[model samples]
Target: MSIVVSLAVAVAVLLLMPATATLRTRSPSVLPAFVSLPSAPQLRNRLMHRLLRRQARDSRRRRSLRLVDAMVCELRAGLAPRAALLAATSTLTEPLCPRAAAAAALGGDVASALRADAASLGLPLLIGVGVCWQVSESTGAGLASGLDQLLVTARADEEVRAEVAGQLAAPRATARLLAVLPLFGLMLGSSLGVSPLGWLLGSPGGWAVLAAGVGEIAVGLWWISRMVARIERDLMGHVKGAQPR
Candidate 1:
């Protein structure tokens, strides 16, 4: 009779386990009930999107710089404004190049075309080129000199950005290391014959503790990201504002 009762109690506990887990998952006390971990697919998509945007941005910057250098060279070679733009753009594959060159060839508003291309292509650097073109056209200023100055300013801005990135690298690495340290702790615990995962998943109190830890990690990561973003934004804004109009 004693053995039968003990077996019945064990079975009852086993049956209640799933229900307990479900309840804990649905309403973890440390996080909002609606908050849940993102699925693998969601994470993959986000990472891909960020990579593509960075690639596109870098490509656009390179093309803009190349176009400016080419145009400056053509102008310094004694070409007319229209001929210089046509010659410079003819060497590049950027979608904006052909349209701006066509506008120059046809005696349309090349500045407007450049500006339109800059806006459509998400290339803010070209906006400065457009402005230089417009001012030179209206005031009979030296186009080559204007573009050369623009190139110098652009290179300076790039250097500042690179320096800022270098400065932030240490903080970024630190944040990443901090985020991974918990995993190291888990591994250490396992190596010592401690079932850390089992303990964390074994009871309602453990579930609450795990949820709190996850929430804290997420918050710390977000705070670091926000700080980095804010620093970059402010510095970039200051650089732009300090540039000559």
Candidate 2:
């Protein structure tokens, strides 16, 4: 009788705990309309990750872009690159922003800061602009045109990625559903005795079950990864003027 009561309590806890917890929790957040992004952001996430890998988020990407935009605006106002970038850092917190500002404070070049984080945008183009500025100090030949083109291309690529993320949202959510269904089954098993799960817990059969579980998890992960990589490739191809080779 005690054993049966314990099992009953365990089953009740298993079902009710998660339900009440979820119910009492804040409603899941939705993307702001300004962002109006895809619901399954994981499809755009680049890795099959564990704890720290997920946490090592680089919010600096947008900050770096903002810094560049500010630099461009200030330069168009006739400030030098060094001065413009220095002025822009007050509005940015990218890892490279402060260094750019300090270099300017020391009367050093802003091109160095641009070069340092230029790969985040396009290193070669930033360096090329630096070269142009140095060579044609007074003649504004083509520099403005190149900057305009670069910004246009960058914005277009960003839009393409947003669209791809939207397209892959359903697949990503499906993968997540597949991952959770087994857990739900496991919980149900603890109540109904339908799970031959003891065979999974105690012997050579246990090891076999563990191995099979591991393999299934790996396959599910690989499927998700392939789906994401395909989308990434397609997005890049669109940028590159060809289908993914």
Candidate 3:
């Protein structure tokens, strides 16, 4: 009788064990926790970084244009090419100014030095300057007139680019809004107690869906950005190519 009772207790305990396991599996704490997303500070920092980079690029372009205009003025005033270049460097800062001055003073390949400096600064206008210098050196042609024309064309190109950028502003904003719409929707659902994040973090199907959605968003943004950039580059290239070589 005692052995039979003992066996019955053991069987009961085994049955309870599965129930306990199931309960543990279904516990609230057992749900996969969502990873912490980037906080506001991190997002702000990223935005600041982007803004700084854009400003730096704009500043570099502006400085390069100014250098070209200054050189044109100095050249028109009857200074030699090397003298005009060195004078232009007076208004500018390193590394272009210092490098250019050194090259000019050293009596080395001034055009080549200018080209190198322009390349390092990512300034396309300076390429025209180098070309002007090279032509003057090789053929004894006047550089002042060419540089003046280049400056005029460059200004015109900048105006056109500004217009293009203005036109693109709306599209860019729309793309950004679309990229963030999913996040807003998720937040909305969460506010309504729908537990969207919980679902996304907790289940295999949800994980797959989330991954696909994120990938689609990223690819779409990348494609749009790439297309716009390519178009801008093509347009700029066409303009540059049309300029007097």
Best by lDDT: 1
For model 3, what is the error of residue 206's alpha carbon versus the real structure, in angstroms, after optimal superposition? 2.8
Superposition error at 124 for model 3 (Å): 2.1
| Per-model TM-score versus the true fold | 0.73, 0.63, 0.71
Candidate 2 stretches with Cα past 4 Å from truth are 1-58, 107-109, 119-145, 195-197, 239-245
TM value for model 1:
0.73
lDDT tens digits by residue: candidate 2, 121-208: 4334455445544544456564445555556665565666667778777877788777656555565666666654455434455445
lDDT of 3 by residue, 64-175 (tens): 7888888888998999989898888788874454566787888888888778877887888888888988998899999898888889887888876786677678878888
lDDT against the true structure, per candidate, is 0.75, 0.55, 0.72
Give the number of the best model, judged by TM-score: 1
Itemize residue pairs with steric clashes in candidate 2: none
For lDDT, candidate 1 versus 3, the one ahead is: 1
Q: lDDT per residue, candidate 1, 24-141, as tens digits?
A: 4423553353247443344446658987998888788887888889899999999998898888877877555566778888889988888888888887767888898889989999
lDDT of 2 at 228: 81
